[model samples]
Target: MQVVIGKAITYEQQRLIKIVQKQLSEIDKQHLKELYEVTRIKHEPKDFSINEVKREIECGKDIQSLFQLANTILPQLKISNESIKYYASLVGYYSVYKLK
Candidate 1:
């Protein structure tokens, strides 16, 4: 019975992780799209892939690592530290939701 309950809990956690991943992906897509639009309007579009950045974030990279990646791809765009923190927080949330 205990083994069955443990398996059930693990399964539920996996399900939640999938659901959260989907939701976070959608949110990141929308967020990146909006940022891209703004940058385009300013005639300073960065040559970066939103999907790639999202993948890196989802892979549990540290916030410093994210900033490093962002700096490499978006040197001209001044991304505030607060904004990085916000993105890091989202990654942290996703990580928590992905626990099994």
Candidate 2:
């Protein structure tokens, strides 16, 4: 029996996709003990900036939804959900620098 299945990634999922991409940029500068290139995520666009992800979060988006989104995007990239949220939270922490 062959069954075709596709996952419905939501708006929050899209936001997490952006968050994961932004987080990767900062982590890329650090010395990773593991070769993260093997863990690189492809579908999320590089153009989605931290500020953009922040906008999504600031627009009354819930954290639980964001976490669910994170699960979908980062699993393929081999990143854990906790690590994903920790990095995404930095978007709020470092938001001042993002303001021009």
Find the candidate with the highest TM-score and give its number.
Answer: 1
- Against the hidden reference, what TM-scores do the models get? 0.27, 0.26
Which runs in model 2 stand beyond 4 Å of their true positions? 1-61, 80-86, 96-100
Whole-model lDDT per candidate: 0.48, 0.47
**Full-model lDDT, candidate 2:** 0.47
| lDDT tens digits by residue: candidate 2, 1-100 | 1232223336546766676566554433232223222122212434669976665555434334434544555666565779768866655455323421
Off by over 4 Å in 1: 26-100
Candidate 1: tens digits of C-alpha lDDT, residues 1-100: 9999999989866865565455444545444444322222223224558965664554444334434435544433344678657855554344332421
> Could you give the C-alpha RMSD of every candidate to the true structure, in order shown?
15.5, 17.2
